[model samples]
Target: MQLSNIAHGPEIRDEAVAFCLWAPLHQRVTLKIEKRGQWQMKRLADGWHRVEIPGARPGDLYTFILPNGLEVPDPASRFQPNDVHGPSEIIDPTFAWRTEPWNGRPWEEMVIYEMHLGAFTEAGTFLAAIEKLEHLRRLGITAIQLMPLSDFPGRYGWGYDGVLSYAPDSSYGRPEDLRSLVDAAHGCGISVFLDVVYNHFGPDGNYLPHYAPIFSDTHKTPWGRGLNFDGAGSRFVRDFIIENAIYWIREFRMDGLRLDAVHAIRDDSHPHILCELAERVREAVSERPIHLIAENEDNNADLLARDAQGRARQFTAQWNDDIHHVLHIAATGETFGYYRDYAGDGAKIGRALAEGFVFQGEHMPYRGKTRGRPSTGLPPTAFVSFIQNHDQIGNRAMGDRMNASHPIEAIKAIAAIYLLAPQIPMLFMGEEWGSTDPFPFFCDLADELNETIRAGRKEELSRLPGFDVNDALDPICESTFRQAKLQWRGAIHNEPFVEYYRLLLSLRRKWIVPCLADARGHSAKYDSDGRLVCVTWKMGRSILHLMANLSGEAVDTTVPNRKDIILSQGDIAPDRLGPWAVLWSLAQE
Candidate 1:
């Protein structure tokens, strides 16, 4: 279990602790311990400053003073006690094991439930989230994918604009509290995953540009300058990002990482940063199964390719937005923006179900260019399917859930289809009980920056239908953050929706999971007649079938005859399928 020297931060020696800082731009660097004497750091040749402090223990607050007299926290700080701009706290990484060593569950058994820590509960703390683990376990969720925990500015945000890559947000309790949450989850037989952003740092509180060459001059992303992955001073930059991924998996004991928007990561280096990060993480942990999921809009199948042994070569899976787009349009008929590429195309849904992507090297009118590569070579497990997620719900003009405006029957029909499909299934927070609580994009930053965000959000969503500027919530408002919190009391009355999800998950575990390990790529055949989508997958010796009519009128479609009926929503007759009807069955191949 060798670790990388790129693990930059305070490292506790036998008696004294060694602190290292990578400041290439600075010739003189000083380490300042709060209420203690300041020490001059020795400069190393590779742009790193080193200092050793005797009698320095955990809980000591420290910061680095550059030659220009500006202070900055450690880029790899383990914890921040007082937000992003505050001092970094020394944390003892030791934790007592309450459970036996968790080897982690197989990827085939993953039923992911994505959640935001701040909005997951009223308390919005890691300890508070531990209280709800039992509820998720009972709901048959094998994996809990936590939204980003990296420290961001102010009180609340989606965790995407995180400046401190290593520190968990101080707003959500201490580092030990997060460890307890993960320990408790592992004790309950649930794998914990973390969402991580490495493409670019947040807009505010990022002091890297002042001290280090972290951004590339040639490349730019949607969020402005991209990280220096293939630039002149990129070796250390790539090492920094790769080590962050390793630190999360090795130190925090996270079972996996959901890389946010990997398409934005531009690297021309051989053995790209994505590849190197995956390889290093796999090398660091071998006792447990470590899954790496990506949110790549490019629909690049090469990232999710498998070896000859049927194991993933790089990433384990990706968030399949194609299936989500087609399903959303079928349910709500809203075809604005990217949804236009999938609107009125029932075959796109079939392709997303059987194959992974709908636009596999095909022209997408929305992007005005060809999008995605061939994805049919990948297994269905390589894609994760979901009806609603944070981006899908929060990115809307009103931040509304599908259940907020669509019919219950329509939502249930899509749920039955994806929940039973061969691909992995993920649920947004409070989605199991048909929660309509709006998870609008909320953030707290400087007043000037907040105004910019407010205006930007309004301008971006103003073109969409039914968007009213007067009704739009200010993203900077504290009340906007509170509005996104989950209301647990609403679930008490939504028992039917809860039961439906539980039943679908239970059926998946019993009927689908057992055959998934042997599931192969290009083993599914699908057909669609505008609205009626029928797909069949060859899972081992069993044949799994799905018939869905996403139209308002009943369709005269022949239903496949299978004695082992898994589940059915709406009317399913011999020759006529009711509006919004979905039927799933299994039979001998």
Candidate 2:
């Protein structure tokens, strides 16, 4: 098997360890293993430095020494016991067999539950997260998607601002603890998917800028400079990201990965970095199925399309922001910021249901340009839809969930659309029970960068009308982190929406899952005058219809006669629908 230069990070073999570092610009590099003194590294062709230490083993701490007498932690460190600035420790990659025969669950059977390890439980450790998996299993979640865990500088973060791509954040416990979580999740018949960021690194504790030309000034991102994926010294950078993807799947047994913000990954190279990454992952996993998802803001349809050879070009699914935007507008009737492009009406939902993206090649007034490609050719299962996620909820000035902004009936109606639709569905943590706790944007940053983050967050919130910039919660504050943690007991007992979610998920598995494979079998319609959105889905011989009234006032409407009434919530009459009434029935033709 061929290996990338970044693939070998302190590989322990037969009582000796081999260390490899790509330092083409530097004339000399030294391997400084703690307690073992320093050993000069031999410079190889193409700017790589290599050294073999006989006594080095799995638990050793090491750093690389430069000609200027400065020492830095390994860029591809597997474990950083002393945080991001400390020496990288050699961890035992070996684990006992438990989920060996586990081929992950099918993508078609997936109902994803997105979670934050720290915010999901009171203890905020991987083991603590394991204790709550049974609840998700009972809720009928087939997959769990965790936010980024890459090692960052501070004690708490959203995980996007990570410096070390290889190491799991030690704040979440040891790397072994993470392994146990995945192993346990598989034992419960749930697959684990990780969200990974490769567009840029965090500001603090990011030593790659000094060691190598790892970033480019050509393309700028909101967070930082874009990664140099197409310029000089880009081959190694591409390998670095591809290897990181494989490491998570091979080392920790992760079932899949969700690439964060691929629109920022600007690469003009022929075979795009995303395509190469997907191909490498497929090669690494061999015959075992692994899911690859992308969060593309541009709404490019080709991200999930196949090449001429019938090979998947990039990912299995792309996070469908259009669906969420239209639903949010219809539910809350707020047409500000990016929501202005979507009309807050029931017809928008019907359009999204029939065609994949309502904004397909249409000129977007908010951006003053065309935004998305035609996604009608793409399968509905190729898009992941959700009403609320971390970015949509937490990026708000108050970090309010959808349940907090809209009425209970409106929330339930939107929930039914997302869950029962042909597109893949994901639930935010604690969203099942409509938890009132705000998922505010919180991060633990060093003092030097604290004010910058605070000011940036405040400026972003200023775009929303009537929002007080001064009253926004500090992202760097400890209280903000505490406020985001889920109060599981309170939400489960007090919130009635929990039962709504359970019933929807049950119906999804029994009725909707079978029809997701064929996008043509689904159709939707809506009447603006009646304020009603109706969807009809045909699965083999079983036909199902879902009608929802999103208006505040009761709506009188004609109802088609159906024999099987699978599920009905709120007011459902033969010809009239009370405000926010959603009814699901099976029709015989």
Candidate 3:
């Protein structure tokens, strides 16, 4: 895999350990080991400083003193015992994997469950999460998509604002603890996928810019300066990012990675950084199925293209926000912001189900631009659909879930459609039992940055309907972070929702997953009349049909004549679908 070429940070050997740092702007770099003697790093021609310490064992705390006397953690640090501003800890990557070697499950078998480590349980630790793996395995979740774990400043933050890309956040647990969580999940027959943010570092505690050419002046992202992926000194930057992806796959034995916001990653190289990273990761781990998913707002179907053998050419699938928008509007009828473009558009709901995207080459009024390319050529598995994810729920004025705002029937109808659809399905944490507890945006940062974020969040929420800035939760407050935690007690009261999800997922495993491996694009058709949606897919030799009435009133629609009924939600008469009703049936040709 040529992992040696991409190695950075501290490398432990049999008797000697080597430390490497890329500090192009600095002429001298000093390695400061805690309670140990310091050593001057030798400079290389390509801006890298290196030093080897014999008998330097694991559990050593160290930092690099720059030319300006500023101490900073390793850009590729494996673990941060303290926070981001603290010294990096050298970790022994080797672990006695308790589980037998696992090659990962197929992409079609994935029923993903997205979770935030901090809010997933009361303990908010990796080992604490391991205790719930059996519950997930029984719930039919083949993959557990964890939120980002990179080291961010302060106590807590959505991991998108992470600085040390390679270090797992200390707030959750140590690097070895994370490995234990993965090993434990695999033991329970569940794959672990991590969400990673590579577009930009957090607002605070990022020291790469002081020593290396990390950001490009030629490009900018919404967050700030974009990463240097195509500039003059971009080869090393590309290597750093690509190596981070491979490190998680090889070191942590992660089954996959969900690249957060690839659209924000600005790179004009011959092969984009996204493409390069995927290729490198695949090369690094060819023995097992290592899936790479993207959360791109651009809806670029080209990235999810399949080869002649129906294998992904680059990314395995994308988080389809289009389907979520359409389904959310159908359930709640909220038309503010981006939802306005999809509101009352029954055709979009049909297209999102039958095809992969709704805005393919169409003008989106919300963004004031033409969004998305043709996605009908790709397989249905190219899109991952979800009704409520972190962003959709947390970004709101009050992190209100779909169940909190809409009727249970409405939420269940939408769940029935997506959970049993041909596309990959993902459930946010606590969604199975109709959790009403909000998953609001919460972070702990410097006082000044916290105030700035709080004000900005208020201003953004004021634009939404019925939002009051005065009533908004302070994101930096410790109480707000605690408020987002999942309440397991609610599961007992909402057992019906759990059973509903289990039934749908079990049907998906038995009927849908087997045909998905050979499923192709442009093999589905749909018809929507007012509030009624009917879609049919030709999955291999089997025909899967879906019919639903998403409104409060009953709608008359012709039911497909197939006795192989998988599920029927609400009342489905011979010629009419009752309010919030959904029906699914499969017939073999």
Candidate 4:
């Protein structure tokens, strides 16, 4: 359980290399070295095959050969220098870490900036991304959440389809390059978090089924068969995932991991995989702050709650879709699909601001079921609220961002509310300055699979009311990927919006962040007209008020204590707000 010597990958030593694997079903297993022949491995006591090569050293390529003469890449491969279908490479984990004794920033102090490495810069490599760390630091970002780096079978992807769980994508630079990027981020006082997929493997190049019963035929996910967690032979499968969680934090020195989707990880056992993972990750860190964030569509507030005996559950924070959905509806007034429930009537958005989730035991027509549980007593920091994230943008038919459909003032108002809210805020890459580039859905699949995915996307969009299937970009096109790249100069040209963001973030850091430690100190109220919502925060008599107007016309309403106004946008009158305006103020008394 310590994962010190019990790791399941190729371990390199000075004189001899020990390779360990969990292949209980196979009676005979061989370690096939590239161009160096093969060696039979002896089965160990705990259903793992073990082999030690005397002359093996770092940078060696190896694969596990099963009894059926099928050579498969290591399920726990650390470096897939070749594609996912090729042999795994041995990586020298030794790096001169400059930030020794690096205690990461506290969870409450994080203002995360979610980025896609390939689209973040023109170079689109790990080393190239290092140059932008200073720019992020200057923007007051405390953490950088990299989209999944695990190697998938493609030239590029949103990174959700990663099959080689341990290997960083070879399309990006080498393993050392990723380490260098982390090192540089640490040097800039930015904590690095990796987004890891645990629910299901990719469609193409997935060889897990060849080695063991890792997938459950009984349970399925949107991608395919759900991973084996509760069924027979599940202990090893669960261990595989838990070990991966530990590997990222301990080996990569990542401050935390953003678990891709917990709803898909089906487990009905006592002390669920989510709870076990949290416990194990805490034990592995041994006091260093390592955050675990979950992306759960269920809006289960208990994921962030403490149990009856006062033990932590699920994760440190959950992706609050309620917040994003309300903001989206308030901005665009698009009432189709899931957005139908969030009609921008002010009650739903107000509830989300007050208690973290709006659908707390309420019937949701979109899914035709009652959704969410009450989260009133939980800490505000337990939820991660974002105006725009990768899924909300890239998963769209056309991969359009928040600015694509909403007015500039409306976008600014929503961004202001999210940043100044008590919960942790996350900004999508290029969102600060309203980049015009569309973060369209793009992936690299085989020729046949590519055609199938393209057709499937068109069909999915055809069902949606407002979507124009013809406008959707080809997911397999090279031009689609290039079109999503950020134009950094957009930040310069959109200076007003950039300054608005910088000012609100600075104000939140100075005033709002201090109040987030106490959950009971925050409250929200919305006008009956469904156009204005005011969120108030109090930390030992220090009161901060944020008022936002979601209407399309000016509102003749009294300013909520404008004397101590710190930040104001759009038409700011003494007792009125212009269309799509916002005000952040503090109580003088």
Sort by lDDT, best first: what order?
A: 1, 3, 2, 4
Clashes of 3: 0
TM-score, prediction 1: 0.98
For candidate 3, list the clashing residue pairs, or say none.
Answer: none
Better of 2 and 3 by lDDT: 3
Compared with the true structure, all predictions reach lDDT values of 0.90, 0.84, 0.90, 0.83
Q: TM-score of the candidate numbered 3?
A: 0.98
**Weakest 10 consecutive residues, lDDT, candidate 3?**
1-10
Candidate 3 residue-wise lDDT at 107: 89
lDDT of 1 by residue, 220-263 (tens): 99889999999877888888888889889988899999999999
Evaluate residue 527 in candidate 1 and report its C-alpha lDDT on the 0 to 100 scale. Answer: 92
Across 493-560, the per-residue lDDT of candidate 3 in tens digits comes to 88877888888899999988987866953399998877888898997788888888899999887777
Runs of candidate 2 with Cα error greater than 4 angstroms are 1-6, 306-312, 519-530, 537-544, 586-589
Q: What is the TM-score of each candidate against the true structure?
A: 0.98, 0.95, 0.98, 0.95
Worst 10 residues of 1 by lDDT: 1-10
